[model samples]
Target: MAKSLKSPPADLTRISTRNGGTFPLARISKVISGEAQLPGGHGNREMPVWGPFFSRVDADQDLGRMRVDSLARYLRKIQQP
Candidate 1:
């Protein structure tokens, strides 16, 4: 996962059909909300899906949201200018 994240495709706007994956870094919020979809109906590439994973971790909606937000913010911060 670290390797993949460290070397994402140069063009994030384009979706890759071959791998059934999407770089939600540019739109992290949508991905977190399950509003993003991939080919073959596979949801966001992140296994276990962070939204549900965070919810299960604490069973608190606010805490889950905080976790997702923190992740999204981190992604945004690391993006190249």
Candidate 2:
């Protein structure tokens, strides 16, 4: 996944991370739903706010093709406000 300097869509619910990473929750939902893909190969310079910087792919893979109904609630509990 090449990091996009381009702006993300307006309607997305984005979770901003350190080092210029913004993971749109809806887009990630799409990824998990098979409506999209988030392939590996982008480096650790940036990553979805979900996991440790070095292994974001593993985190994403763990959520693959599965619907996690409480993603926002889960993320909210774990992540800083």
Candidate 3:
């Protein structure tokens, strides 16, 4: 006889603020595929996801850190009041 696995309880901590007020799996898949707009009209199509990767590269010892430091310094200067 094959044993049946019981279904887990629904997670109550999840929340959403979009039109449906829930992050449906289908919508998340669409967003991942660059076919859906996020809340407030923002979408992944307009932004490149490279900041964290560059940060990691900046911290690597084998790569030159001077250019990364210079870019960081420039960004800090631009953000100064």
Candidate 4:
């Protein structure tokens, strides 16, 4: 399909913000492919999101979960006066 000037791209092309996260491209891909979700969250309830946050943890933990609360905590951690 040709590029449409009426709406945004169906698949993410770039990430304008990382929200203190890493690998912007990979994150975008996960969301675009609808593979982003919590360990036991709702099924088939995924939606394209912006400015995602991620955590790097142990092997037994959720090493690559995309969640908004993660972003919330990060924002609070780096809040400015």
Candidate 5:
């Protein structure tokens, strides 16, 4: 008897929850402008914030399609009341 081949499980992508688990768009801009603040009442100081920086792609760039329902659900989960 031949054994059946098993398929691998689907990959699960996770969102980062650092910095209060929120996307800091304003904070990022402030940091770029040299006016960012530290958390917990710490005095203002220069800190190196490193992350991926991508150039602006065309509006019609087609990497792939995202499920709107899934994205809406995720956004709803993270939204503050």
Candidate 6:
């Protein structure tokens, strides 16, 4: 079964904002694709590389792309107005 897309937790979002994490969709897409590193570089030390992690879960590039796209879209939707 595929993992469902969901908004990030409010605490995490708040922390990101506190730490200067406002990234545009294009950059967010790159982060999702693993083409570009996340801002601040902490993800490199603390978290699994999402691109590879998501890929390993299903081992399907197309499905991984869909999942990443869905997540990126969700992040975009939650930006402060």
lDDT against the true structure, per candidate, is: 0.54, 0.40, 0.39, 0.39, 0.35, 0.60
Model 1 per-residue lDDT tens digits across residues 1-81: 555653333333333322245335545555664655522344335433567777678668888877888876665555543
Top TM-score: which candidate number?
A: 6
How many steric overlaps does candidate 3 have?
A: 0
**Leading candidate by lDDT:** 6
What ranking emerges by TM-score with the best candidate at the front? 6, 1, 2, 5, 3, 4
> Candidate 3 residues 1-81, lDDT tens each?
113423332222332332245445554433333345643453223433333444466566434333344443443344312
lDDT assessment of candidate 5: 0.35
In every candidate, how many clashes are there? 0, 0, 0, 0, 0, 0
Off by over 4 Å in 4: 1-18, 21-23, 38-81
Model 6, TM vs. native: 0.57
Mind giving the per-residue lDDT tens digits that candidate 6 earns over 20-42?
76546666666767778655564
lDDT of candidate 2 over 1-81, digit per residue (tens): 234634332222334443146545665554334344444423432324332322344567554333343453454345432
What residue pairs are clashing in model 5? none
- TM-score each candidate: 0.51, 0.31, 0.27, 0.25, 0.28, 0.57
User: RMSDs, each prediction?
Assistant: 7.4, 10.5, 18.1, 11.6, 14.5, 7.5
- Residue 77 of model 4 has an lDDT of 50
Q: In model 5, what lDDT does residue 59 have?
A: 42
| Model 2 TM-score, 2 decimals | 0.31
Query: Model 1 — which ten-residue stretch has the worst lDDT?
Result: 10-19
- Evaluation by TM-score, superior candidate among 2 and 5: 2
Candidate 2's error at 65, in angstroms?
Answer: 11
User: Local error of candidate 3 at 46, Å?
Assistant: 4.6
